[model samples]
Target: MTFQLAACAEMLWRDRPIDWRASRLKELGFGVGLWNWPAHDIAALERTGATFTIMNGYLQGRLADDEGADMLLKSARETAAVGKRLGVHRLNLHGTGLGDGGIPVWQHDKVTGPMWLKARDTLNRICDLAEELGVTYTLENLNLMEHPGCPFNTTADVLTLVSSVNRPQLRMNLDLYHTQIGEGDVIRWCQKCLPWIGEVQVADNPGRNEPGTGEMNYPAIAKALKAMGYSGPVGLESNAEGDPEVALQAFRNAFTV
Candidate 1:
């Protein structure tokens, strides 16, 4: 079976306008993925008529404190409005706010018991908001090297949080790129995260470029996903190694099991 293929417009065609990138992805028969919504032309994006699979769910927030939780809920509510306006399928979130260079705004050297409890509570509240808004939100995993000190940034940590909550409105973004960097057992992680996965994102390790440009064997990974019955959205959240179209075609080829 073929997966629902999409590409992060923000990562590709950087020299082009955002709408132009979205339009090109659409014309190429792929859905679009976005980053922060405020940086783009909403009207122009709407005109493109691309199927927006997912985008950042919050502008600024954290998941492990009262003050951060409040900020998270407020930001999520505001972003949900934009998500609904664009008819985006899923809204994505991280453990906390990421700053310049993808570093966590709030850093934690070690997560404590109370922090874990608070993070789960905050996610439950996020689910409540999602149910109210008639939208789904995904908690994404980030690697330590790129996003040091970020809490709940591991695949295991993200899975634990989402599974503990066990709500449909909240699910795992299941980014294999980060998992490959942090934890090498990609197929096993896929099996563990299968039930609660909202979407599966991909980029090769060592370079953060399209599938074949690095160490990960994406075609094998794709076949594994099909075997596990995860025929959901698979997004190429990678930069083009060369031509954007060529990179996207490589992504499509990898997942076309």
Candidate 2:
């Protein structure tokens, strides 16, 4: 199966108009990942005739209380509605962590367990909302150092969460950079959890920049993905060191059709 290349909108935010960014993606024969893009921007993107492959909905740990959880759920549902309207099918999300002057949400602390359970329940609600909105909800694995409070830092953790949730709409958003940084065995881990994968993001190790500009062997990684019959977008969720066009060229050269 052939996979689509996608540019993360955050990369070109400083240098290009949103329409121009879409045009560049079209020129490269790619899609786009709308990272925390506002709902109002959907029309502008629609005008470019580019597909929004991934939509990210905001979530923080400070909102785990009943009132906060309710608000977060509402926001997630609304975001999913917006995503569906924009023709986006997958929504990526991060786990909530502990707030200031308190125990972390995913740690061994007493508050952590309850908070995690509540968050898990909230995620299930979000998944239900996603289905209602005609979208898939994917939980992303964060780098251990980057997200110390997150309980899920490994593919195993992600698999465990999915098993507990047991929902078709709730799946994993596997990010190569975080996997590498977290010391995950990328190929083996991905193979083990292939069935749960809903989306995939790519970047190089150490610097989290465009592939080939860093130490990641993207060709090998691409080979693994193809072997696993992954037919989703290979999202370019990385920073562009020089020009976005240059990053696009590198991605094209690295992956095979």
Taking the candidates one at a time, how many backbone clashes does each contain?
A: 0, 0
Clash pairs of candidate 2?
none
lDDT by candidate, in order shown: 0.95, 0.72
Query: How close to the true structure is residue 3 of candidate 2, measured as C-alpha lDDT?
Result: 75
Error of 2 at 172 (Å): 0.8
Error of 2 at 210 (Å): 1.4
Off by over 4 Å in 2: 59-68, 97-112
The residue ranges of model 1 lying beyond 4 angstroms of the native Cα positions read none
Model 2 per-residue lDDT at 116: 58
